[model samples]
Target: MSKRIFVGYATKTGSTKETAEAIAKTLSGRGFGVDVKPFAQAGDLGAYDGFVLGAPVNGMAWHPDASAFVRANASTLAAKPTAYFLLSLAYGVGRASMKRAIPARLAPSSALAKPVATACFGGVIATEPPIVLRLLFGIKKGSPRDSRNWDDIHAFAEGLAAKLAPR
Candidate 1:
């Protein structure tokens, strides 16, 4: 039977969704049957053999929907070969910048199921928000940058695929 992989993500302005799609594509290229869905639309995690849960980091916290999905399906996830990835500005610059943005608290835990691997990738910042939203939040014009490292993402997906390969 083909391994079933589900990539569920919560995105505000589409960055996280893009990352999830990319991951699904990579896994599909590696021969796994992959499903990429928005966290709100994802249903029945128990059907998949493996899962990749991801979200964009906002205000130093993960999106509530993404976190809730994992929490709600914690048991089913714990039983499978699961993995997690994050998208943030951290992965863009040097280690110091990455470190400051990606915190240990954000990493997947055994409580959420011992994922085969976890990753933090860089993300984008858009400039189309309303002025009030930007000013109230003290948001500045962040440079358009994609800190996503495709090589690392591919390697991680491949590694997970190998681990979940049929015995």
Candidate 2:
């Protein structure tokens, strides 16, 4: 039987969900049985052979639900081949500090259970966010942008097939 992979995502503005779908599609094409769902609805973890957790960076940290998922499923995740992927706007604007900061942010999940793989991808942000979101992100005004690199995202999924190869 093909390896069954579960992809659970936590999305704020929905970009992470899309990324999860892309990863699931690529992994499915690679012959693994993949299921993608939001963290709130992600079903039984014990049913899958491997897992991929996707989340967007928010306020310099992995989304809270992502962190909570790891915490909730800590033991189950430890026994499986688990991977992680992050979508963040932390790239391209040339913030060198993010290199160190992002990993620090990821600790909440990574510390709970070691992962077989990890990937960080560029993210998307709306130009005119709601006033609260704008204030939270320190956004004044600008054109919306999507810096997601599909090639890299697909390549990450391809690499995951190897990392999650059936035992």
Task: List the candidates' TM-scores in order.
Answer: 0.80, 0.86
Residue range 2-66, candidate 1, lDDT tens digits: 79888888888898887788778888888899889987777777678888888877765666776
> What is candidate 2's lDDT per residue for 1-167, written digit by digit as tens?
88899999999888999999999999999999988999988877778999999998887888899989999999888788899988877542224565446656677688898899898887887664566654544444552468688999999999998998744
Give the candidate number with the greatest lDDT.
2
Runs with alpha carbons beyond 4 Å of true place in candidate 1: 94-103, 108-110, 128-144
State each candidate's clash count.
0, 0
- Which residue pairs in candidate 2 have backbone atoms (N, alpha carbon, C) closer than 3 angstroms, thus clashing? none
Q: On a 0 to 1 TM-score scale, where does candidate 1 land against the true structure?
A: 0.80
